[model samples]
Target: MSRDHQASSQHDGTAGDVVVLSQGDHTLVILYGDVDVRVSEELEHAGRFSIDAARRTVMDVRHVTMMDSVGVSFVVRLAAGLRSAGTELELQGPSRRVAELITLVGAGELARWLPELPLEADVSAEQA
Candidate 1:
Protein backbone atom coordinates (compact mmCIF):
# COMPACT_ATOMS: atom_id res chain seq x y z
CA MET A 1 0.00 0.00 0.00
CA SER A 2 1.08 3.51 -0.66
CA ARG A 3 0.05 6.66 1.14
CA ASP A 4 -1.29 8.98 -1.51
CA HIS A 5 -2.73 11.72 0.68
CA GLN A 6 -2.25 12.98 4.21
CA ALA A 7 -3.28 16.04 6.17
CA SER A 8 -2.76 17.05 9.75
CA SER A 9 -3.32 20.17 11.78
CA GLN A 10 -3.91 21.70 15.14
CA HIS A 11 -7.42 22.99 15.20
CA ASP A 12 -8.74 24.84 18.19
CA GLY A 13 -5.56 23.82 19.96
CA THR A 14 -6.22 20.11 19.47
CA ALA A 15 -3.96 18.00 17.31
CA GLY A 16 -5.50 15.85 14.57
CA ASP A 17 -4.17 13.78 11.70
CA VAL A 18 -5.47 12.01 8.61
CA VAL A 19 -3.60 9.58 6.40
CA VAL A 20 -4.95 8.00 3.26
CA LEU A 21 -3.28 4.78 2.19
CA SER A 22 -4.26 3.04 -0.99
CA GLN A 23 -3.73 -0.43 -2.40
CA GLY A 24 -5.46 -1.47 -5.60
CA ASP A 25 -9.20 -1.04 -5.03
CA HIS A 26 -8.89 -0.55 -1.27
CA THR A 27 -8.08 2.58 0.69
CA LEU A 28 -7.34 2.88 4.39
CA VAL A 29 -7.91 6.17 6.17
CA ILE A 30 -5.97 6.40 9.41
CA LEU A 31 -7.31 9.02 11.78
CA TYR A 32 -5.65 10.10 14.98
CA GLY A 33 -6.23 12.41 17.94
CA ASP A 34 -9.43 14.35 18.44
CA VAL A 35 -12.13 14.36 15.74
CA ASP A 36 -14.81 16.82 16.66
CA VAL A 37 -16.64 19.78 15.19
CA ARG A 38 -13.42 21.72 15.04
CA VAL A 39 -11.97 19.41 12.40
CA SER A 40 -15.10 18.32 10.59
CA GLU A 41 -14.24 20.18 7.42
CA GLU A 42 -10.85 18.57 7.11
CA LEU A 43 -12.26 15.16 7.88
CA GLU A 44 -15.04 15.56 5.36
CA HIS A 45 -12.61 16.58 2.66
CA ALA A 46 -10.46 13.56 3.33
CA GLY A 47 -13.44 11.22 3.37
CA ARG A 48 -14.60 12.46 0.02
CA PHE A 49 -11.20 11.98 -1.50
CA SER A 50 -11.00 8.45 -0.17
CA ILE A 51 -14.41 7.56 -1.45
CA ASP A 52 -13.56 8.80 -4.90
CA ALA A 53 -10.25 7.00 -4.96
CA ALA A 54 -11.26 3.45 -4.07
CA ARG A 55 -14.13 1.01 -4.19
CA ARG A 56 -13.53 -0.07 -0.58
CA THR A 57 -12.57 2.34 2.19
CA VAL A 58 -11.49 1.38 5.66
CA MET A 59 -11.48 4.17 8.22
CA ASP A 60 -9.09 3.23 10.99
CA VAL A 61 -9.78 5.31 14.06
CA ARG A 62 -7.94 3.23 16.62
CA HIS A 63 -5.62 6.13 17.41
CA VAL A 64 -8.41 8.64 17.72
CA THR A 65 -8.67 9.82 21.30
CA MET A 66 -12.02 11.55 21.12
CA MET A 67 -14.93 12.12 18.78
CA ASP A 68 -18.14 14.07 18.96
CA SER A 69 -21.51 13.93 17.26
CA VAL A 70 -20.15 15.55 14.12
CA GLY A 71 -17.61 12.82 13.73
CA VAL A 72 -20.23 10.16 14.22
CA SER A 73 -22.50 11.81 11.70
CA PHE A 74 -19.67 11.99 9.19
CA VAL A 75 -19.02 8.29 9.42
CA VAL A 76 -22.69 7.36 9.08
CA ARG A 77 -23.21 9.67 6.15
CA LEU A 78 -20.04 8.56 4.40
CA ALA A 79 -20.96 4.92 4.77
CA ALA A 80 -24.43 5.55 3.43
CA GLY A 81 -23.11 7.46 0.49
CA LEU A 82 -20.61 4.75 -0.37
CA ARG A 83 -23.32 2.11 -0.15
CA SER A 84 -25.46 4.08 -2.52
CA ALA A 85 -22.54 4.23 -4.92
CA GLY A 86 -22.10 0.45 -4.83
CA THR A 87 -18.92 0.84 -2.78
CA GLU A 88 -18.14 0.00 0.84
CA LEU A 89 -17.01 1.86 3.93
CA GLU A 90 -15.78 0.22 7.09
CA LEU A 91 -14.91 1.78 10.44
CA GLN A 92 -12.03 0.12 12.24
CA GLY A 93 -11.17 0.18 15.94
CA PRO A 94 -12.96 3.16 17.38
CA SER A 95 -11.89 3.92 20.93
CA ARG A 96 -14.20 2.90 23.75
CA ARG A 97 -15.41 6.43 24.40
CA VAL A 98 -16.19 6.98 20.73
CA ALA A 99 -17.84 3.58 20.51
CA GLU A 100 -20.08 4.38 23.47
CA LEU A 101 -21.08 7.68 21.93
CA ILE A 102 -21.94 5.97 18.64
CA THR A 103 -23.96 3.32 20.47
CA LEU A 104 -25.75 5.95 22.53
CA VAL A 105 -26.76 7.71 19.38
CA GLY A 106 -28.24 4.46 17.95
CA ALA A 107 -25.34 3.95 15.56
CA GLY A 108 -24.11 0.75 17.18
CA GLU A 109 -24.70 -1.09 13.94
CA LEU A 110 -21.66 0.70 12.61
CA ALA A 111 -19.62 -1.53 14.89
CA ARG A 112 -20.20 -4.31 12.42
CA TRP A 113 -17.52 -2.71 10.32
CA LEU A 114 -14.92 -3.02 13.02
CA PRO A 115 -12.12 -5.46 12.24
CA GLU A 116 -13.00 -8.86 13.61
CA LEU A 117 -10.99 -10.37 16.41
CA PRO A 118 -8.84 -13.39 15.67
CA LEU A 119 -10.65 -16.70 15.48
CA GLU A 120 -8.80 -17.96 18.55
CA ALA A 121 -9.82 -14.90 20.50
CA ASP A 122 -13.45 -15.35 19.55
CA VAL A 123 -13.36 -18.99 20.51
CA SER A 124 -11.76 -18.20 23.87
CA ALA A 125 -14.34 -15.54 24.60
CA GLU A 126 -17.11 -17.92 23.79
CA GLN A 127 -15.61 -20.60 26.02
CA ALA A 128 -15.16 -18.15 28.84
Candidate 2:
Protein backbone atom coordinates (compact mmCIF):
# COMPACT_ATOMS: atom_id res chain seq x y z
CA MET A 1 0.00 0.00 0.00
CA SER A 2 1.12 3.53 -0.76
CA ARG A 3 1.03 6.39 1.67
CA ASP A 4 -2.30 8.18 1.87
CA HIS A 5 -3.07 11.33 -0.10
CA GLN A 6 -5.48 13.57 1.73
CA ALA A 7 -7.22 16.92 1.24
CA SER A 8 -9.72 19.00 3.15
CA SER A 9 -11.94 22.02 2.58
CA GLN A 10 -14.14 24.22 4.67
CA HIS A 11 -17.12 26.43 3.84
CA ASP A 12 -19.78 28.29 5.76
CA GLY A 13 -18.23 27.06 8.98
CA THR A 14 -18.59 23.45 7.78
CA ALA A 15 -15.75 21.17 6.78
CA GLY A 16 -15.02 18.00 4.81
CA ASP A 17 -12.13 15.65 4.11
CA VAL A 18 -11.05 13.46 1.19
CA VAL A 19 -8.51 10.74 1.79
CA VAL A 20 -7.16 8.39 -0.87
CA LEU A 21 -5.28 5.22 -0.13
CA SER A 22 -3.76 3.05 -2.82
CA GLN A 23 -3.40 -0.64 -2.06
CA GLY A 24 -1.94 -2.38 -5.07
CA ASP A 25 -4.85 -2.64 -7.54
CA HIS A 26 -7.36 -1.19 -5.11
CA THR A 27 -7.88 2.37 -3.95
CA LEU A 28 -9.87 3.34 -0.89
CA VAL A 29 -11.39 6.80 -0.90
CA ILE A 30 -12.70 7.89 2.48
CA LEU A 31 -15.03 10.87 2.49
CA TYR A 32 -16.55 12.55 5.51
CA GLY A 33 -18.38 15.61 6.80
CA ASP A 34 -19.88 18.12 4.38
CA VAL A 35 -19.09 17.30 0.77
CA ASP A 36 -19.87 20.38 -1.23
CA VAL A 37 -18.29 22.95 -3.55
CA ARG A 38 -15.61 23.61 -1.02
CA VAL A 39 -14.05 20.25 -1.50
CA SER A 40 -14.31 19.95 -5.28
CA GLU A 41 -10.61 20.50 -5.86
CA GLU A 42 -9.60 17.79 -3.43
CA LEU A 43 -12.21 15.45 -4.84
CA GLU A 44 -10.89 16.05 -8.34
CA HIS A 45 -7.36 15.29 -7.22
CA ALA A 46 -8.45 12.12 -5.45
CA GLY A 47 -10.44 10.95 -8.48
CA ARG A 48 -7.49 11.42 -10.80
CA PHE A 49 -5.24 9.48 -8.47
CA SER A 50 -7.76 6.63 -8.18
CA ILE A 51 -8.20 6.32 -11.94
CA ASP A 52 -4.49 6.37 -12.54
CA ALA A 53 -3.54 3.93 -9.80
CA ALA A 54 -6.25 1.36 -9.34
CA ARG A 55 -8.44 -1.13 -11.17
CA ARG A 56 -10.98 -0.95 -8.35
CA THR A 57 -12.04 2.05 -6.28
CA VAL A 58 -14.16 2.02 -3.16
CA MET A 59 -15.55 5.31 -1.91
CA ASP A 60 -16.48 5.17 1.79
CA VAL A 61 -19.14 7.72 2.43
CA ARG A 62 -20.45 6.35 5.70
CA HIS A 63 -19.13 9.33 7.64
CA VAL A 64 -20.52 11.95 5.31
CA THR A 65 -22.96 14.27 7.00
CA MET A 66 -23.95 16.23 3.91
CA MET A 67 -23.49 16.29 0.17
CA ASP A 68 -24.45 18.79 -2.50
CA SER A 69 -24.38 19.11 -6.29
CA VAL A 70 -20.60 19.34 -6.41
CA GLY A 71 -20.21 16.15 -4.46
CA VAL A 72 -22.70 14.33 -6.68
CA SER A 73 -20.92 15.57 -9.78
CA PHE A 74 -17.62 14.31 -8.44
CA VAL A 75 -19.08 10.83 -8.02
CA VAL A 76 -20.66 10.93 -11.47
CA ARG A 77 -17.48 12.01 -13.16
CA LEU A 78 -15.37 9.48 -11.32
CA ALA A 79 -17.80 6.68 -12.15
CA ALA A 80 -17.93 7.59 -15.82
CA GLY A 81 -14.18 7.86 -16.15
CA LEU A 82 -13.56 4.59 -14.34
CA ARG A 83 -16.18 2.81 -16.42
CA SER A 84 -14.51 3.99 -19.60
CA ALA A 85 -11.23 2.64 -18.31
CA GLY A 86 -12.88 -0.70 -17.45
CA THR A 87 -12.40 -0.03 -13.76
CA GLU A 88 -14.88 -0.65 -10.95
CA LEU A 89 -16.30 2.01 -8.65
CA GLU A 90 -18.13 1.14 -5.46
CA LEU A 91 -20.06 3.68 -3.40
CA GLN A 92 -20.21 2.36 0.10
CA GLY A 93 -22.71 3.32 2.77
CA PRO A 94 -24.16 6.51 1.44
CA SER A 95 -26.74 8.09 3.68
CA ARG A 96 -30.36 8.29 2.56
CA ARG A 97 -30.04 11.98 1.80
CA VAL A 98 -26.90 11.47 -0.23
CA ALA A 99 -28.44 8.49 -2.00
CA GLU A 100 -31.54 10.49 -2.80
CA LEU A 101 -29.50 13.30 -4.33
CA ILE A 102 -27.58 10.85 -6.46
CA THR A 103 -30.80 9.23 -7.66
CA LEU A 104 -32.43 12.58 -8.23
CA VAL A 105 -29.56 13.62 -10.47
CA GLY A 106 -29.82 10.44 -12.55
CA ALA A 107 -26.47 9.21 -11.22
CA GLY A 108 -27.81 6.05 -9.64
CA GLU A 109 -26.54 3.89 -12.47
CA LEU A 110 -23.07 5.32 -12.47
CA ALA A 111 -21.69 3.23 -9.63
CA ARG A 112 -22.60 0.20 -7.53
CA TRP A 113 -24.03 1.23 -4.17
CA LEU A 114 -23.20 -0.88 -1.15
CA PRO A 115 -24.85 -1.09 2.28
CA GLU A 116 -21.55 -0.80 4.14
CA LEU A 117 -17.85 -0.20 3.71
CA PRO A 118 -15.32 -2.99 3.74
CA LEU A 119 -14.05 -4.13 7.09
CA GLU A 120 -11.40 -1.83 8.49
CA ALA A 121 -9.72 -4.79 10.13
CA ASP A 122 -9.28 -6.49 6.79
CA VAL A 123 -7.61 -3.45 5.34
CA SER A 124 -5.47 -2.99 8.43
CA ALA A 125 -4.39 -6.60 8.30
CA GLU A 126 -3.26 -6.11 4.75
CA GLN A 127 -1.28 -3.07 5.81
CA ALA A 128 0.37 -4.98 8.61
Candidate 3:
Protein backbone atom coordinates (compact mmCIF):
# COMPACT_ATOMS: atom_id res chain seq x y z
CA MET A 1 0.00 0.00 0.00
CA SER A 2 1.12 3.52 -0.73
CA ARG A 3 0.72 5.75 2.25
CA ASP A 4 1.28 8.70 -0.03
CA HIS A 5 -1.78 7.78 -2.02
CA GLN A 6 -4.10 8.19 0.91
CA ALA A 7 -6.29 11.25 0.42
CA SER A 8 -9.37 12.98 1.81
CA SER A 9 -11.64 15.65 0.43
CA GLN A 10 -14.01 18.10 1.99
CA HIS A 11 -15.94 20.98 0.53
CA ASP A 12 -18.76 23.12 1.86
CA GLY A 13 -21.18 22.30 -0.93
CA THR A 14 -20.32 18.62 -1.19
CA ALA A 15 -22.79 16.27 0.40
CA GLY A 16 -20.33 13.64 1.61
CA ASP A 17 -16.75 12.85 2.53
CA VAL A 18 -14.22 10.31 1.28
CA VAL A 19 -11.08 9.23 3.10
CA VAL A 20 -8.68 6.68 1.70
CA LEU A 21 -6.49 4.61 3.96
CA SER A 22 -3.68 2.26 3.08
CA GLN A 23 -3.84 -1.19 4.67
CA GLY A 24 -1.17 -3.50 3.33
CA ASP A 25 -2.74 -5.41 0.44
CA HIS A 26 -6.09 -3.71 0.87
CA THR A 27 -7.27 -0.12 0.81
CA LEU A 28 -9.94 1.14 3.18
CA VAL A 29 -12.31 3.86 1.97
CA ILE A 30 -14.24 5.63 4.71
CA LEU A 31 -17.32 7.46 3.47
CA TYR A 32 -19.35 9.77 5.65
CA GLY A 33 -22.31 12.16 5.33
CA ASP A 34 -24.71 12.11 2.40
CA VAL A 35 -23.55 10.19 -0.64
CA ASP A 36 -25.94 11.03 -3.42
CA VAL A 37 -25.44 12.08 -7.00
CA ARG A 38 -23.45 15.05 -5.81
CA VAL A 39 -20.36 13.03 -5.03
CA SER A 40 -20.37 10.54 -7.82
CA GLU A 41 -17.24 11.88 -9.46
CA GLU A 42 -15.32 11.94 -6.22
CA LEU A 43 -16.41 8.42 -5.41
CA GLU A 44 -15.46 7.15 -8.81
CA HIS A 45 -12.01 8.71 -8.69
CA ALA A 46 -11.35 7.41 -5.20
CA GLY A 47 -12.59 3.96 -6.11
CA ARG A 48 -10.37 3.75 -9.14
CA PHE A 49 -7.34 4.98 -7.25
CA SER A 50 -7.84 2.43 -4.50
CA ILE A 51 -8.33 -0.39 -6.96
CA ASP A 52 -5.16 0.56 -8.76
CA ALA A 53 -3.14 0.67 -5.56
CA ALA A 54 -4.31 -2.58 -4.01
CA ARG A 55 -5.71 -5.92 -5.03
CA ARG A 56 -8.34 -5.73 -2.32
CA THR A 57 -10.49 -2.75 -1.36
CA VAL A 58 -12.92 -2.22 1.49
CA MET A 59 -15.46 0.60 1.48
CA ASP A 60 -16.49 1.36 5.05
CA VAL A 61 -19.71 3.32 4.93
CA ARG A 62 -20.68 3.04 8.58
CA HIS A 63 -20.94 6.81 8.86
CA VAL A 64 -22.82 7.47 5.68
CA THR A 65 -26.01 9.31 6.63
CA MET A 66 -27.75 9.13 3.27
CA MET A 67 -27.45 7.71 -0.21
CA ASP A 68 -29.37 7.34 -3.45
CA SER A 69 -29.34 5.28 -6.62
CA VAL A 70 -26.15 6.98 -7.76
CA GLY A 71 -24.34 5.68 -4.71
CA VAL A 72 -25.62 2.18 -5.30
CA SER A 73 -24.54 2.26 -8.90
CA PHE A 74 -21.10 3.41 -7.90
CA VAL A 75 -20.56 0.52 -5.49
CA VAL A 76 -21.91 -2.10 -7.85
CA ARG A 77 -19.83 -0.81 -10.73
CA LEU A 78 -16.71 -0.59 -8.62
CA ALA A 79 -17.15 -4.10 -7.32
CA ALA A 80 -17.63 -5.43 -10.81
CA GLY A 81 -14.55 -3.66 -12.06
CA LEU A 82 -12.42 -4.97 -9.23
CA ARG A 83 -13.66 -8.49 -9.76
CA SER A 84 -12.86 -8.31 -13.45
CA ALA A 85 -9.32 -7.27 -12.58
CA GLY A 86 -8.88 -10.27 -10.26
CA THR A 87 -9.16 -7.94 -7.29
CA GLU A 88 -11.74 -7.88 -4.52
CA LEU A 89 -14.18 -5.24 -3.31
CA GLU A 90 -16.08 -5.30 -0.04
CA LEU A 91 -18.58 -2.93 1.56
CA GLN A 92 -18.53 -2.69 5.34
CA GLY A 93 -20.97 -1.30 7.85
CA PRO A 94 -23.22 0.63 5.52
CA SER A 95 -25.69 2.81 7.39
CA ARG A 96 -29.36 1.77 7.61
CA ARG A 97 -30.46 4.30 5.01
CA VAL A 98 -27.83 3.26 2.53
CA ALA A 99 -28.50 -0.39 3.24
CA GLU A 100 -32.21 0.11 2.70
CA LEU A 101 -31.62 1.77 -0.62
CA ILE A 102 -29.38 -1.06 -1.67
CA THR A 103 -31.98 -3.57 -0.59
CA LEU A 104 -34.74 -1.69 -2.36
CA VAL A 105 -32.74 -1.99 -5.53
CA GLY A 106 -32.48 -5.76 -4.98
CA ALA A 107 -28.79 -5.30 -4.43
CA GLY A 108 -28.72 -7.30 -1.23
CA GLU A 109 -26.79 -9.84 -3.26
CA LEU A 110 -23.98 -7.35 -3.37
CA ALA A 111 -23.59 -7.99 0.31
CA ARG A 112 -21.14 -10.63 -0.75
CA TRP A 113 -18.70 -7.77 -0.43
CA LEU A 114 -19.66 -7.22 3.17
CA PRO A 115 -17.47 -9.47 5.27
CA GLU A 116 -18.64 -7.74 8.41
CA LEU A 117 -22.10 -9.26 8.05
CA PRO A 118 -22.66 -12.76 9.34
CA LEU A 119 -23.40 -15.55 6.89
CA GLU A 120 -27.05 -15.54 7.89
CA ALA A 121 -27.33 -11.80 7.45
CA ASP A 122 -25.95 -12.08 3.96
CA VAL A 123 -28.46 -14.72 2.96
CA SER A 124 -31.51 -13.40 4.79
CA ALA A 125 -33.56 -10.30 3.96
CA GLU A 126 -34.39 -9.80 7.64
CA GLN A 127 -30.89 -8.52 8.25
CA ALA A 128 -30.62 -6.54 5.05
Q: Which has the greatest lDDT?
A: 2
Off by over 4 Å in 2: 9-14, 117-128
Of 1 and 3, the candidate ranking higher by lDDT: 1
Estimate the lDDT of model 1. 0.73
Q: Which runs in model 1 stand beyond 4 Å of their true positions?
A: 9-14, 116-128
Local distance difference test scores for all models: 0.73, 0.84, 0.72
**Residue-wise C-alpha lDDT for candidate 1, range 1-128, written one tens digit per residue:** 77677665432334666777787878787777778776787778777887677478888877788887778897787777677767878777777887788778866664346664444457899899
lDDT of 3 by residue, 40-81 (tens): 777887778876775788888777778878778878777777
Write candidate 2's Cα lDDT for 1-128 as tens digits. 77568665432334788888877768899887899887889999999988887478999887788998899999999999888888878988888898899889988888888776456767899899
Model 2 earns a TM-score of 0.81
List the lowest-lDDT window of 10 residues for candidate 1.
6-15
By TM-score, the candidates rank as 2, 1, 3
For each predicted model, how many residue pairs clash, with residues at least 3 apart or on different chains?
A: 0, 0, 0
Residue pairs in candidate 3 whose N, alpha carbon or C atoms collide under 3 angstroms = none
